[model samples]
Target: MPTLVKRLLAALVIFLLLVVINQYMSKEGLFGFGVPSYYARLIVLAGINIILAVSLNLITGFTGQFSIGHAGFMAVGAYSSAYLTVYYAQAWERSLGGIVGGSLAHALIFLLAILVGAIVAALAGLIVGIPSLRLRGDYLAIVTLGFAEIIRIVILNIDSVGGATGFTVPGYANFLWVYAFAIITIVIVYNIVHSDAGRALVSIREDELAAEAMGINTTRYKVLAFVISSALAGMAGVLAGHYLSFLSTNDFQFIRSFEIIIMIVLGGMGSLTGAILGAIIITFLPELLRTLGPRLESLLSSIFGADNIPASVHTFLLQLANYRLVIFAALLILIMLTRPQGILGTREFGLSWLKRARRRPEGDKPVGTGGVSIAEQEPPSAIDRAKEVKNQ
Candidate 1:
């Protein structure tokens, strides 16, 4: 088949799939198969987290960098995007409203804003990755963390972007936009990891010195991974900022960075599937706890009789919901102790599993007499030759 034909077919298939996904996810459905509004929001948030986690995985998992300031790049994306949408969305509404209408005009406007954010974030990645090339392990971690703090502080002091008061973003981003970028992020990261560059990245992770000794440009590849990861994190930040319709420096604080790191760690550092799984679990866990806490408190109150319970106890019950981080931390500790490799542990689930099943394991070859490899021995040409060999 011609390459052009193959490319066209692939493009067509992707377009169709995107259309189908958009329809199914929309409030109105083709076959009455629309998702509920509440679940839809969760899915969107999960998609954003997935992008964040997967990008982080490329740097930390595949490239063997232990960065903890990912949230800083996200902050760069979020604030820049938010600023554009909030401050400049009216330009779109005023100029393009007649052509694209209010909604789509705003979306296009914000999409451009998001691109700016992503670029800024990628540049920030270069800023951090380049200066700290000689640093490794905790030293690099500290540098990244410092960079994130610097970003947050800079945002906090920027009077035009709401300063410490924070900025309100237009609600231009939705599930469709979020999921679209998420899928793009996954595809890009997956392709990078599966390519020759990915091997070099992984080799750097395995042993930087050895990879360098083999003539691999370790610093360049590491920086490339950093920039890509940072850009994707920025994209995630853009989605979040637009979705929430607000932005605060506090929102992109160090803890947010840690949460992203935790997601990658919990999901399995090097596995895309693991990143996704970790993202889902991490994103939903707080909601679950917050929801469950009240129900459990009500059950306890009802069972024990409300009159018998002290006001202090009631207050404590309410506060229990806020301890989700503590609960999450405990769970993380348990996971580390039991399955240190994470849920997937650098493994993925796909057609590759089927391929593995079909091939015999390298260690499974049969050993003949005197430890000879049966695989290496050829059979007799004829039955008479076999008989003569047996007689000998």
Candidate 2:
């Protein structure tokens, strides 16, 4: 089959899957079965985090630039799009709803909002990248981090969007929209990584000075990666803001930026699949740990008999659960010590691994077979090739 047809089929399948998932996530059951709201919400948020992580990977991972201001771009997207939807979306939706169906109108408006958020975030990235990107190592990190805090502080004082209190906007995003964009972000980053520009970006990461010496225009590519990363982050923010139906400066705190950094680092800085895995782990790990206390208590009670278990022991177990963050930190430290390169270490998870597994070892083939043995197959030496060339 043609690649285009395959892509279209894949797209259709993904759309249908998302639709089924959205229905299951809704209050009303899909075919009498539905996921609990809590799980559904977690999945949606995880998708958003995936976008943020993968985009950050492009700049910091593939392009070799350290950036901690992703949350700032996210804030820019959230508030700017929120400002649009709050003040203008209704009128435009009503006007367009009459011409097109209500559903289409709402989607159109939200898409416009997403575009606005992305563009504005890209502009913010450009503004920040131009000056700060010139700096390298810890200085660049400090500048990006400072810029993120500055954006957060500035947003805190803007009363139009409710300032410190927060801003509420229409709920126009759901599982389908969020995941669709998440997939788009992944595809974008993947293509960019595999393309000529991706090669240039990787070159810059490997050695910026060497890339510049080769006339690769290091600064332009760095800024491009930064802008693209920022824009995708903004899009994630738009989805997040619209899905949550609220925007808060508190959500875009410096810690949030750090969390994004942690996702990429924990996953493997240069790996796309690693970023995604990291995002999922980061988003769900804390919640998963929430059950540890009760489970541990139950296990101890079963072993010692409930009557024999001391109140103090139970108290300690509960308290330990509360200290899960400390545990989480320890786990991260352990991972870093054992596998500092990260879970994947710049490798992707795919069918290629299977192909590698199927390959035969060199010299393993029988000599009697029609195929030439690896040990017997040889190329002409360099000297022989040079003599032949001279003779020719």
Candidate 3:
């Protein structure tokens, strides 16, 4: 079949699959045990993580910049979006009274919040990227880490926006909003990566000095990558904040930044598909572990006798709920030490490889009207060619 036709068919199949899954969840529940709401939340979280990972991969993986303050940008977005939603929702409620209380107004407010969040985050990215990107490697990482902490502290002090006490946001984050943002994020990143600007970014990643020597403004591309990545991270934060319907300073912290970095690293940095896969796996793995924790505890109690089990064992098992960070850190260390190129490395999965593999099975054929094969008919050694020319 033609490539275009194949692509269209694949897209249609994906769309149908998504629709079927949505219908199934609506009817039979997402977890298959009648708890569709929880599964829906999980899917939303996975989408947000995928956005975070893929966007950050553009900077850390493609541009070779160590950004540790992505969560700060996310915090900026979340607080900005939350403030807009709460403030506007209240104003709309007061102005329109009962007319604006339904799903339509809520949907409008949610969109407004997303826009506000993205703009706020992009502005924050500009501020942070300008000064912090002047440094490189560990210095850049340290600056970003400090920036994130500063954002958290600032959020904590803002009383009007709930200050230290978290504020409740309207629960307008449904499957539609989450998946839409995720799709937009993915599409934007995909386009950017395939553009000339993306090539410049990759060149800078390969060698900043060389890129500069080639007349490429390395600083400009770096800042551009940072801004785009930060904006996407902010979008993810908005979705997450609205989904939870609550916002706290703790939600956007250094640890959150590290978690995003882990997703990018595990996914293979520059690979977009790897980013999505990594995000889904990382986001769902903790939930899976939580489910297993109880069974493991029960088995241990049966083996060791429930009465003899120490209280600390329960505490230890409970700690596993938060121990995802530990696992993430260990996995990162292992990757860095062994396979720093990541799971998929820098190569993208494409159909051209399959075509090339198929061609390889055909082997060599004889040249037309000659005993020589195609390979043998090629130019001889440079010196021999030169000697033949001289002799002729």
Top-TM-score candidate index: 2
Model 3, global lDDT: 0.82
Worst 10 residues of 3 by lDDT: 356-365
- In lDDT terms, how accurate is model 1? 0.87
Cα error, residue 97 of model 1, in Å, equals 4.0
Q: Which stretches of candidate 3 lie over 4 Å from their true place?
A: 1-20, 26-36, 90-104, 293-338, 349-392
Q: Judged by lDDT, which candidate is best?
A: 2
lDDT of 2: 0.93
- After superposition, candidate 2 runs with Cα above 4 Å error: 302-304, 354-392
The C-alpha lDDT values of all candidates are 0.87, 0.93, 0.82
Instruction: Write candidate 3's Cα lDDT for 152-226 as tens digits.
Output: 899999997899898788777756567767877888888888999989988988899899999998888999999
Clashing pairs in 1: none
lDDT of 1 by residue, 155-250 (tens): 999998999998887777777688778878888999999999999999999999999999998889989999999999998999998888888888
Cα RMSD for candidates in order: 5.3, 5.1, 5.5
Query: Once superposed on the true structure, which residue ranges of model 1 sit more than 4 Å away at CA?
Result: 1-38, 99-104, 293-322, 351-375, 378-392
